[model samples]
Target chain A: MTEAQEKNIPDVSSDFEPKIVAFCCHYCSYAAADLAGSMRLDYPTNIKILKIPCTGKVDVLYLLRAFEDGADGVIVAGCEEGTCHFINGNIKAKKKVKYTKKILDDIGLGGDRLEMYNLSAAMGQKFADLAKEMTERIKKLGPSPVNSGA
Target chain B: MIVGEQKPIEEISKMIAEYKTVLVMGCNTCIAVCHAGGEKEVGILASALRIKNKVEGREQNIEEASMERQCEREFVDELADKIKEADCVLSLACGVGPQTIVEFYPDTIVLPGINTTFYGMPKEQGFFVEFCGGCGNCVLDMTAGICPIVRCSKSMLNGPCGGSQEGRCEVNKDIDCGWQLIHDRLKAQGKLDFMDEILPPKDWSPARHGGPRKMVREDLKIDEKPEDEIEGITKEGEK
Candidate 1:
């Protein structure tokens, strides 16, 4: 209806292909993603997987960089609670995710763009499902304001 | 040690919006341990600011520098050249740190990037509690190391007033009763005799109530000449 509103609307004709980053922990989610491929499970190609030793290694800086570098949405998948390869890495990552989410809200980036989940090595189906779910969510939110210049 | 927390990125972004070039300075001593104004925090804040720049489609020079202890003159000196190059400085240290920098570089515009909170210690990982009031005089020995000036909700020298219930202060149910802690500690150490002794009223003048206090270590002076006699030397140093 308005120029500002028009700018925020994702271009549907060209098909908005949102770029998503999934920081997968080596002990669990990474293996699950690998298994997803072997099992011929379907997940959106929009998601780009980055292997990290532990989710605890994910810093607020890394998440900020992803969005700043044109990521429409970001996911941090680590081992389930109390089951981290490193004692409490996933718990620490959960806190960092919560912290970064608040930071995203502060910067007007919409905290909903970032999400965190706890997964195990055998949950290939769950991993693929979350990837598709996040892809759909980002598609609904449209391009990040950082990339859209809105 | 002084404890502090960095102000929100949005708040800091607003403070430096008018300046084209900013120097984000950090102090690594106490604030660093608290994960606030340390070298690592300086880098984080700088990166966040850069992201804001991209989001807003604006560009500015953001420089980062950190000192071992910004409150100390020796450490603050390391930032002098960097401070001179920037249009303004965003200081991520405690209250004393920004003042120390301003005292040296009188012409520079210094903006606070953090809020200096209190004289405190880490209660545990990621949590800090204020323990001291910096009252200039301490009553720790009489109270068995528990400070009534700060730890006590009312700073009551003879407390546990009707407000204390079940070892919790009335001010906040989560806070421990300062006098209750003192009483328990004194009883445990067999030092309850302190309770029998009527303590004298404290001298408030020794604290911040006296206004702008100074500590002089005459022995540490290089030249002990009085202020009036050093006119030529001091005048030159002022510039």
Candidate 2:
């Protein structure tokens, strides 16, 4: 945690809704989210999914923009390692997400607010579970500290 | 190419703490190629600053702009209007970029957002190695292309020092012995005889010891400050 965020961790309300931004890769996590919808799997509606051609296209700029724009949490969803649509898009994305996490940590937003998860098209259950897990995690972390200033 | 890395966010934030409006400038050339200061990096740094300001409760007006090259006068001139409006310019270019900006807009406050690291090339993705020391002398032909000045820890010109062991430098085993590399390359090219020449000591005067150096080509001169207004131009051969 940065000095800016060391002041205090305020208690979140019982009905706090986290604004989660999910950058889902088209070949895998997007398909997983679609299948999750088709299977009638109940997940947090707070996860706003934005589809991209591949996770490699996810730049550090995109991740920072999410927090700057009031996202309580950010998720980078890509294909399972070594199973990328563009050979190594997920690998690049994984590294980028890790780098962005450090940047987020530097800004006192706490790296916990950002995460990267690998998924496959068939694993709808995993998608729903990860979303739930992320939502719960963010709920514990409360709203992003950046939002406090806004 | 000149490589650089961005400074810590805290340091950068502190630099602009006194200013309200900032123009985040970037160059799309060498620094960009090394993933330091480019257009994409401009966005990243600008966004990070915005986030930091918001998180720290600082009301700042930050804008971002990138040029083809910040080392050039024409490109640096294009950002004049933006530089004029901002309280200061945060440059995401190598050291030369900020200096160039100051040379042109003397009144504008310019700060370096990246530290100029070295003259090197990337060995692989996300990996870079220092290749040249820019010592103002060319000894590559005799050294079989391996730069003893930079590749060698001691910058030895003759041969490897006693610290060299197993084809590695004593400074670090990860670093290959520059002389050893030169030996192997020379042997392969049937130029091993050059190693036995026992070359004389290098002329340090031509290097940095001679102070700042400048080169001018008479034929390349396009600007006119009046041929007789040769205050700084030194006569080469009186031609």
Q: Which number leads on DockQ?
A: 2
Give the per-residue lDDT of model 1 (tens digit) for A9-101. Answer: 665444889999999999999999999999999999999999999999999889888887889999999999999989999999999899988
* Candidate 1 ranges with C-alpha deviation above 4 Å: A1-7, B225-239
- Ten contiguous residues minimizing lDDT sum, candidate 1 chain B: B230-239
**Tens digit per residue, CA lDDT, model 2, B36-154:** 99999999989999988887788999899999999987898777789889999999999999987877677789999999999999999789999998898879989999999999999
Model 1 complex DockQ against the native: 0.47
Per-model C-alpha lDDT, please? 0.88, 0.89
Evaluated on the second chain alone, the candidates' TM-scores are: 0.94, 0.93
Q: Give the range of the ten consecutive residues with the poorest summed lDDT in model 2 chain A.
A: A2-11
Q: How close is candidate 2 to the true structure, as a TM-score?
A: 0.93
